[model samples]
Target: MNLKGKTILITGGASGIGLESAKQFLALGANVIITGRNKEKLDQAKKLYPQLTAIQNDVSNPDDALKLYHIAESLGGIDILYNNAGVSNPTNNLAKANDKITEMAAYEMDINYISVVRLNNLFLKMLQNRPEAAIINTTSILSYVPSNLAPTYSATKAALRFYTASLRNHLEVAKSNIKVFELLPPLVATEMAKGIDAKTITPETLVKALLDGIQKNKFTIRVGDTKVVYFLSRFFPKTAYKLINPVKNSIKLSA
Candidate 1:
């Protein structure tokens, strides 16, 4: 769809892929609003792009999403909802860290999976008021297979993939103009992927791919390792899961 004169909202858009997308969209003459949990970061982004609207909203919080929806409505309604907020950690060897697993499950599930769903529901009303609308889910290459560094993060992305397909199919069956989009990115060199030697998917390449896909009407757009990981996971579900999910042995038992 045409980005010009459109109003777009991106979660976790203060930095990383979301930030790059905001910059691109703004350049295309779209009114971009980026939401984040950090006030300082939001202020910094506003300083950089005087035209951009930066809102402080924690996607992981349901109440915050509701509040944000209202705020977005006041800003001429939302034409696009980019569900991009997420977090990850290195879990190559998590051993017996129940605390860590618990934390990861809560944070990852909320930020990655639950928040997306909430925004979709909250914004659908506003989006329907528009001539056309789109929902962009920021899934990852790890959504198909497990990630060596983050088990929970991968699982949540996988869940999001399934949800995105289901939601799109439902909307299509109902004959709605509201489109569902999935953006699966490969491991990119960012603060999130620091110290990792995995090939980085450049932000520019990613945003370009997304725009190209949207123009071509491609819904499930996976760049770089996304297709490979998803294929491996689908064809070799058991093995891929095992590989991604490292063994968590009890040291007491070994002793």
Candidate 2:
């Protein structure tokens, strides 16, 4: 959990939480490789942090994840995998729900859910070669409490939460040294939540807590006010949905 000399791989590392964590990981003296879909943004990030190595890859694609693993193996097998890439499609009230609407949600599932499965498989073998390994799955506060605004996104993360737990149980049964972590991110002020006024947590704060959470063996790390949502939903699952529906409808309205 110290992660001082570990090799790490992260998706969507060009911006937001992914980029912030990359910066922190580099400062901690770890070998880090970041992946992003935007060539221009990746170049900008590289210029900002010349010590960082970046690859242009989208995690939503299994093929891309395979290619990324191949690229990493060529360098060195990663000790940590950060599944941070995700997407949130704008809501629409159209009767058809068209491909465009579903496309982004599907992208979210690919990155938020499927990419972890793919990378874990590719690196699980290599990780088993080592005595210790870690898998950090970036879920959201809405994972437990569905967000109507991000219908598909929330469902996928919820599914990922269960998947993370199951994977951990299996790892325990297998007596593997790998650690599985679930990150329930709140409305951080990252570019992804730029317009929101939810008192975003600084990148430094989030990463510091994240690394600390890993060291403390925290299975689920809910940052900031997100912790409230997690517990409330657990106790009043039905009422939580009723509250979220109105907010989501408002977002759809604005859209």
Candidate 3:
């Protein structure tokens, strides 16, 4: 889709991939609005990119989500809602019966999965009113193969992957103008992936690929290693699983 003059709202835009996305989107002539829970990070982003409208918002909270809708409405609404906010708890021993396991899973699910649905529902009507609009949900390569070190995070992405597909199909059947796009990215050099020992892509490279996909109307945009995993997961499930969880890097968290 043509991004020039379009208004885009990106979640978790304070740093990493979100911040990079905001920069690139702005350079493309799109009016960019970004949201994050930390006021300091939001302020930093605004200072760095004076053109960005950075708002403090926690996507997991229902009230904050509604408030964000109103705030975006005040800015005359947005043409694209980029659900890029996500979280992953530190590696835990899932084999052990730890109370924190459930808590961590719930936290990841809320931000990484549920929040995407909530934001999409909140913006659905507004998006429909626009001449041309789109929803971008960031899933991950782990959605195709579970990461032993990040089980809950993998599950959340998997759930989102299915939801995004269903949402896109539903909109099409209803003859809606709003387009739904699912972005499956591989390990990227971001704050979230700091401790992981893996090959990584720069946020700039990832966002560039994303914009290209959006322009070409590629509904399922898989970048870098994600494309290889997607193919292997379909034809060589075992190899795909092993590729994500290499034996040498395996950590035994439980007896």
Candidate 4:
């Protein structure tokens, strides 16, 4: 998709991957609106990239999502919706026998999975009206291989991945011009991923790859080692789980 002159809305765009992506989109001649729950972070992002239109929004809230949609609509509707808002509690503990689900886990599913669905549905019609449009959802490498350290996060992403695929299929069957793209990034060096020490890609690198993927019309864009994760999951799911689960186990042991 040609990003030039398009309006793009990104959730959690105050920092990390979302911030970098907003910068890139602005650089590519797109009008970018970034939303986050934190006002300080939004201000910080705006200070860095004065071109960005920062909106204080919590995607997990349906009301906030509706407000966001109306805000974008006032700008003549968004050409791209980047669903990137997410949380991760990268704790060392894994679920034990008969352990009940925690509040944090439930919150993860609400924000990561439910919010994405809500926002996508809210913006689908607006996107279809545009000459060219896209919905980019950020699902992680853990979407395929469960992370022992962040079990809830992994499960939420996995659910998101499945939903994204189904949404793509639905759009295709309807012959819609709107494109659906999924970004799978592996171990990005971000504040959200601080505790897990691993070889990581910078947010800038991931955003660059994402822009290129969009131009090439790659439906599922896997950045860095995520491509390997996708391949492993497709061919050797057991091996993929074994390979990733140990990293957290080793970290737990060391701690």
Using TM-score, give the best candidate's number.
3
Each candidate: RMSD: 3.4, 2.4, 1.0, 1.9
lDDT of 4 by residue, 1-255 (tens): 789999999999999999999999999999999999999999999999999899999999989889989989887888999999999865626545334457778888999999999999999999999999999999999998987777889999999999999999999999999899999999899998786667888999999999999989999999888888788999999888877777667558456
Model 1 per-residue lDDT tens digits across residues 171-211: 89988888899999988767898875456888889998998
Q: What are the clashing pairs of model 4?
A: none
Q: Flag regions of model 1 displaced more than 4 Å.
A: 92-97, 234-255
lDDT of 3 by residue, 1-255 (tens): 999999999999999999999999999999999999999999999999999999999999999999999999999999999999999998876777788999999999999999999999999999999999999999999999999889999999999999999999999999999999999999999989997888999999999999999999999999999999999999999999999998755754443
Q: Indicate which candidate wins on lDDT.
A: 3
Superior by TM-score: candidate 2 or candidate 3: 3
Task: Name the 10 consecutive residues with the lowest summed lDDT in model 1.
Answer: 246-255
Q: Candidate 4, residue 155: CA error in Å?
A: 0.8
TM, every model: 0.89, 0.89, 0.98, 0.94
Model 2: CA > 4 A from native? 92-99, 197-199, 242-255
Q: Over the stretch 98-140, how does candidate 2's per-residue lDDT look in tens digits?
A: 7687667667777678877887787888887776788998888
CA-lDDT, candidates in order: 0.82, 0.80, 0.94, 0.89
Candidate 3: lDDT over CA atoms?
Answer: 0.94
